[model samples]
Target chain A: MVYTSERHSHRGSRGRGSRGRRRRHPEPPRERTGGDIARGIVRGFGELLFTAGLLMLFFAAYEVYGKQFETDREQDQLAQGLEDQWEQQEVRGPDSEPLPGSANSRLYIPDLDLQWVVVNGVSQEDIRYSPGHYGDDAVSGGDATAAGQPGNYAVAGHRTPGIFWDLDLLENGDQIVVEDAENFYTYEVIEERTVTPDQVEVVDPDPFNAENNEDPQRSLLTLTTCAPRLNNTHRLIIHAELTDTRPKDEGMPENIADMAPETQAAAGE
Target chain B: MYGLIWRVLPGPWPVKLLLTLVLVAAVAAGLWFYVFPAIDPYMPFNDGAVEVEGG
Candidate 1:
């Protein structure tokens, strides 16, 4: 009887030990505690949240900085296109709009000594130092060079703190260019005019307001920005003439280096 | 009501993982389709026009 009871107790203890382990792990158990399940849920959720947060931060960073690398590469190409411009060929506006991009579509040089690029349209987003057209930078109802005439091709930019701030330093006879995918036109500064915001006619391509006026056909470029340094009431206009157009083939000259954000960073440093 | 809901929803760890994955995916999908393209949050626009030299 003693041997049988002892053996029975040993067997019972083994079963109890196995039961205790199952209680601790509790996989697919018939009954479970509220607390155990809650802990598991909490742990899983915390881990997921942590991973999601990390992924979001990564995506945001990529979206912001990715375009800068693109610009850095294209700057060299833009400079090359400028160099290849033909000496005798004159460039004009595109027959079609250029595809959306941040690189300058064409290169220009009115002075022949200085070359500048026309970012397809003035915008503040891609290039910080751009003469932007959208938002507060755009001077509305500005005259464009009429269909046949070319006198006015006026545009505007911000001056107080951003890219066009240097407009104040621009002098008469300065050159400006508006480039497209195919060709770039060069315009020479004829005069600098300061006018109120209401005076939108100044930017008109045909300021003369004549029908089919040949005078408007003259190659002209106008730059608009806020006037009087830190003031917004008046617009500072720089009027220029289309002196030359260069086709790609003549090749751009050497000595002109690309301006990159790194240049700006260096300036700040 | 909370206790009733909690009792109805068991399988705690597995459910949590699934919910977390769904939430994360939803956010990612929303950003991919709507926020990123519309806002263009990644681009930095700081340049003013620079004069390029030509022939």
Candidate 2:
């Protein structure tokens, strides 16, 4: 490289002369090719595919963990209830058909007119039992046995006022009459408490006991509702113990039919 | 095979860009029209979802 003096030239000024003096290294503006173009596109598409996969994963997690878990529980119960109902069909009626108007299962209240179906399991379909609010699939009755299992069965309902219509008015000691084929189980409310949602131990099969304080004996009934009325911050629990078991012939009210229409198909009548 | 792609890119940019776009559209359209509809039923398009509830 040669250094040029700052002498003015005829072509305008010293700046033009300086540029002319500098060496120029021009190389055909880089190379252009078809393959290079294709690669960029493939790269872009790969990125799009990766993004799509992430989105799909998010949706799958939402369905299983968030949405389906809350409401699909009823379907689980229905399947289980059907299994139990079918296995226990050891007797035959006059028609050789399951009895009609027998309240597929019955619900009774001596204090109020709140006799409804145990409705197999509490799924999204059975929201009417719990103030019309459906639960996802994962939420079990909490205490199925105490509510009215073979020995102890449990039931849960919504407690929103003007919502469940009947369950909302359920007070402490208020009796819940459960009528199955053979007998009507009368369970009396014994205890009530407020617990956080994660404290699921309260609804365990034998959450309470006297022997080991873990092995349960009495037919226990459990009722659950969103605490503080409408808010779900906590669960308002009502615990009841079985008081007496009377033959359905004696306890079933004159009003309730032997079978409800919903159970017509299940009863096989 | 990969070298062929990188080599072409260094030669020209616009033409490569066009080919990339065409390949993507071809793959996507083929899968969507010819493949997806057959398996759509297995997807979670439950029309009765609203009515069925938990059970």
Candidate 3:
């Protein structure tokens, strides 16, 4: 009886140990073949391409919509800052020169139903947030005059949806208004043309005669932006001559006041 | 690739999901604040202002 019981116990223990060993040890990994390696490489390359395509789409969307949001926010801040500056004494005078990158005046296009606070300089850093005024620092090497002065008041802005996107809609006789702390200067559009980027004479005091450095005989306003909206192959230029000047106390200019905000908003849409 | 990352991550499903969301947000912030602005000057649409030299 003892021998039979011992033999039965030994068989049971051996069976349990073998089962445990099998559970602990798994099968060896299979060696990779050339075809398997090639497949893996192709799959990785496809995933990389897919990721790149996604990134590009996101960037394009951000450029179109995200940039507009940034511009709108900056414009609001700049407009408020201009109003504050005007309230605190006088920010600009006939002889006083405002610092570069500073807000100088409010530009209003009644025809387009658009308005923006123009900054002093036209550098990329200066105009990134708002339309910028031309100065001696400009490529034209000519300084812009005061709002109603007898020289060119050149301005440059991006062709984004919030800024000069509809500048081409402006025609002859359209009014472009500039408002300083004191007066509203209205300019009537005289000419609209496209020119090469090198034609800096468009911003000169005398648009027709670049060599004449003397003070321009007439008060002129020049608006410039990139042509084709999406390309920088040329420049779009609009020339206007001052037609009327009135004190701010006299209320808004006639053309601007005639435009109903609701109508303009509908038209913009 | 995403599945591999998910499997390799050492956490519960909820923790892994939270970490994934954080990673996505960081990438978007980086593109919006740094990468996009840095490349803005090179884009044609942003080159609205005319200049005489290499504008």
lDDT of all the models against the reference? Answer: 0.48, 0.47, 0.77
Ranking by lDDT: 3, 1, 2
* Candidate 3 chain A lowest-lDDT run of ten: A24-33
Which model scores highest in lDDT? 3
lDDT of 2 by residue, A1-269 (tens): 12222222222242323363333213121222233456668877887798689556654554334333333344334423543553455444422433221113545565664434445444433543222211222223422342344333545554433223244456777776666667667777777777776665555555564232244555666666556553456666667777777774564443334433434443342
lDDT for B33 in candidate 2 is 52
The candidate that wins on DockQ is: 3
TM-score, candidate number 2: 0.41
Q: Is candidate 2 or 3 superior in TM-score?
A: 3
User: Residues A41-138, candidate 1, lDDT per residue (tens digit)?
Assistant: 88778877987797668556644444333343445444444333322123434333332223333333333332233343444443333342222123
lDDT per residue for candidate 3 within A100-158, as digits (tens), equals: 77777888998787888888888788788788888765635445577788878888988
* TM-score, model 2, chain B versus true chain B: 0.54
Error of 1 at A70 (Å): 16
Q: Which ten residues in a row have the lowest lDDT in candidate 1 chain A?
A: A132-141
**Candidate 1 docking band:** incorrect
